[model samples]
Target: MADTASQLMLGSGLTVVSHPLMYVKMLVQVGHEPLPPTLGRNLFGRQVYQLPGLFAYAKHIISIDGKMGLFKGLTPRLCAGAVGTVVHGKVLQCYQNQNQLEELGSDQKENSSSLDHVIKETTQEMVARSAATLITHPFHVITLRCMVQFIGRETKYNGVFGSIVTIYKEEGVLGFFAGLIPRLLGDIISLWICNTVAYFINTYALENGAVSEMKSYSQAVTGFLASMLTYPFVLVSNLMAVNNCGLAGGSLPYAPAYTSWTDCWRQLSLEGNTTRGNSLFFRKVPAGKSYVYAQKRFY
Candidate 1:
């Protein structure tokens, strides 16, 4: 119980700090269009069209909005994250208890192998994350919408309560769960990949004393790699959720309905030239220096 409590508090704090990075990444990726005016043309006055490069655009955001601008949608994101952490813990516990009960009743329990335990734990994690995603999904939509709105865009949704009320009024209850399927899919893949890789590292890479000391490092690496691998799915989910911010009282059109994950991927891939559409899954440079440069450029 103490460990879980500590984990929850730590997770919430880390998420609060980290959420803005995600917000900025999503905003830039989705807002890629009519290149920033400064970069739209070269010295010759001919249109030197280019897809928004990650670093240049990030610099632009910092320049125009100042430091605080990066954290535009933080409140709702923190709310969802804090509550989501609790929900994840409780749901995981419930599933674990159910699994224990099943093991007690079944004769196979006495003969259960390591592989069986691994599979059971993985299943519990999947269900817990899926349930948590569904419950907290509305907050995610609101956060994304809030983050994407810029100086010229509509700010129909104000704070958390205002956003919820507006979304309910404008788009109905279903609007709250706009990108649920893709989000859930991404969550599941991320959880599985991270857990499996971490477990493998824990088992194979560390000995008794070293294991305790290096556990955090191993887990961090696992998470980074997992996120990178599953980010494309997350990008698609974000597009589905935020493009449909129109449903939540914004100007962007609702993303076209996707009949299946493959269909969605196919459509998103074909819509823009390969580099522009697929750039969301990768980053060319860090934003810190860009933010400083941006501040200097605009302020």
Candidate 2:
């Protein structure tokens, strides 16, 4: 219980600190750029039009909605983080207990190889992660809509209970799970990719006595690589969370009303935006693509 409380507090603190950057990233993900590009030198020392980076985007939001506005969806996000942590812990504990019972009942534990243990642990983590995501997804949906509300200056999703009522009234219960599938898929795929790559590299590639010490960090390295590969799914999921959900940001000019998450994925792929919002800094508009900014204020 103490450990869980510490983790919850730590997770909430990180969420609060990271919310502003995440706010900017989400706006980027939804293709909302109220700020115009400025001429800046690229890494090659050539002058190029660079889209507003994190600080610029954050300042733009502050100008429109004040400093506190940077935390528009923070409440729900905190709730989601806390709930996810607790759910994952409970579910993982259950899985561990079950495994212990099975080990007690069977003699196969002694015969189980290291790879088998790795796979089993990975599978348990995947299951716990999926459950946590599924259970807390409603909070995720609310948090996303609340953040995207910045684009349209909509207050439809204000507080946690209020947002719940609004979603049920406007979009029904299904509204709470708008982007669940892709989020779950991204998480599961990333977990498997991380574990599989880590296992292979640690097992076969790290036979050197001194160099083998790096095996401890293999999972972290592979997890980073996996996140990079699965980032498009995350982008698509965030987009779907707000797509055509009766917000100006979800409509024409800001975004096309995507038929579904897959349709959103297809459109993003065709436009070479599968990796959009992947970077918070050094954003350069694609050559031949130009942005037209309208002088508009929602406040």
- Candidate 1: RMSD to truth: 7.6
- Top TM-score hit: 2
- The weakest ten consecutive residues by lDDT in model 2 span 290-299
Any runs in candidate 2 off by more than 4 Å, and if so which? 107-113, 208-212, 290-299
Superposed Cα deviation of residue 249, candidate 2 (Å): 1.3
TM-score to true structure, per model: 0.70, 0.93
lDDT of 1 by residue, 1-299 (tens): 78677876887788777765675566655643323223355445554433355555556677877778777888888778777788889998887788789879988754332545666677888887787788889999888888777634567768999999998998799888877887788788887887777777877778867877887898799888887777768877776676545532223332455555466568767754112234532332222335344334323
Summarize candidate 2's per-residue lDDT along 1-299 as a digit string, tens digits. 99999999999999999999999999888888777777899888998778899999999999989999999999999999999999999999998899889889997764342787888888999999999999999999989899999988888788999999988998898999998899999999999999888878877888757336787698789999999999999999998888888887777776798888899899999988899899988898666765442224111
User: How many residue pairs clash in all the candidates, one count each?
Assistant: 0, 0
> Would you list the C-alpha lDDT of every candidate in the order shown?
0.67, 0.87
